[model samples]
Target: GAGVSQSPSNKVTEKGKDVELRCDPISGHTALYWYRQSLGQGLEFLIYFQGNSAPDKSGLPSDRFSAERTGGSVSTLTIQRTQQEDSAVYLCASSTRTITGAVEAFFGQGTRLTVV
Candidate 1:
């Protein structure tokens, strides 16, 4: 059983470049979520995928941010035209979709993106 995994534990990028961060959720988990937590800030939900459909994308800051999950497992957050304000820890989490209230998200260490 594997937990969520994210690549480029640290990333330094220019102010206007596109970046793609990868996430591999735990096996058999049907729910995936992406969140952004800036320095000294709370987590902000970016997108959510329950199975193949993303029911919520309201947390995306702007047109530059997008995410997609395939086969209900792996997900990627793509930031187009990175900005300095976008520098934050991108976290990925997954949980089993249960009718009970016991479902909890297991988060990855997160990809720390630094925009310069």
Candidate 2:
């Protein structure tokens, strides 16, 4: 894809249902990130994967949330036994490091998940 892309732009599910959100990062970007934004809130980092390093999962809010990047291009975020509080817009971003070790990221329009 030319840019970061996410699937199911909008999703509505009953409380307790499970949902999976997908992200396709831009080609050649080795660093991928997942963040969650509650209504009227700022983005909260959920997880991050860079190259072959172990993913940084410290940002996940709970055991119910998990994410994985396969082949370092596609990523999926799974929310198991979703709760109403889990409703949010999930955002994905990808970036490549600069020679100076800075990161420049491109973000996808988030997948809005609503748990009713």
Query: Highest TM-score, which number?
Result: 1
Q: What is the C-alpha lDDT profile of model 1 across 21-71, one tens digit per residue?
A: 999999998888999999999999999989878989899999999888888
* TM-score for each of the candidates: 0.95, 0.94
**In model 2, which runs have C-alpha deviations exceeding 4 angstroms?**
none
Q: How many backbone clashes does candidate 2 have?
A: 0
> Lowest summed lDDT over 10 consecutive residues: which window, candidate 2?
48-57
The list of candidate 1 runs beyond 4 A from truth reads none
TM-score, predicted candidate 2 vs. hidden true structure: 0.94
Model 1 per-residue lDDT at 31: 88
Q: How does candidate 2 score on lDDT?
A: 0.90
Global lDDT of each model?
0.91, 0.90
Q: Encode model 2's per-residue lDDT on 1-116: one tens digit a residue.
A: 89999998999999999999999999999889899999899999989888635358899999999888889789899999999999999999999977776488899999999999
